[model samples]
Target: MKAENLAKILKNYTSGWVSISKNYKKVIASGRTLRVLLQKLEKMGNPDGYLMRAAKDYSGYVGV
Candidate 1:
């Protein structure tokens, strides 16, 4: 998926760790931390995904 499009989807998330589906077509789960997110995924049978964080303020935000 395009970065621009992904950004649009992520904008809907105010805070938390977001798990993007393997196909990048949808959000698998979201939680306040990796452990929480992983637990949620475990309940869902642990589908593959990528992790990303959502901020309260995106402006001027920098991630390594």
Candidate 2:
């Protein structure tokens, strides 16, 4: 896809991560969020590596 389209998709993915993070914060207490985040990280192929790393870290902290 074009760079602009990729950027837009990444933006949406970031938003989804934010929402998922919020839910993980509220519901996961055993690192499940961390695991899920790590899984997402593994699936990441975008240039926004930092965001994915942040999400992974956050989820790791929550044990989810």
* Strongest candidate by lDDT: 1
Best by TM-score: 1
Error of 1 at 47 (Å): 0.4
Give model 2's TM-score versus the native structure: 0.23
Off by over 4 Å in 1: 1-4, 56-64
Q: TM-score per candidate, in order? A: 0.71, 0.23
CA lDDT of 46 in candidate 2? 20
Model 1 per-residue lDDT tens digits across residues 1-64: 2333466557678787988876667888999988899899999999898888877676665433
Write out the backbone clash pairs for model 2.
31-63, 31-64, 32-63, 32-64, 33-64, 34-59, 34-64, 35-64
Question: Which TM-score value belongs to model 1?
Answer: 0.71
Name the 10 consecutive residues with the lowest summed lDDT in model 1.
1-10
Off by over 4 Å in 2: 1-32, 45-64
Q: RMSD in angstroms, candidate 2? A: 12.9
State residue 5's C-alpha deviation in candidate 2, in Å.
28
lDDT of 2: 0.31
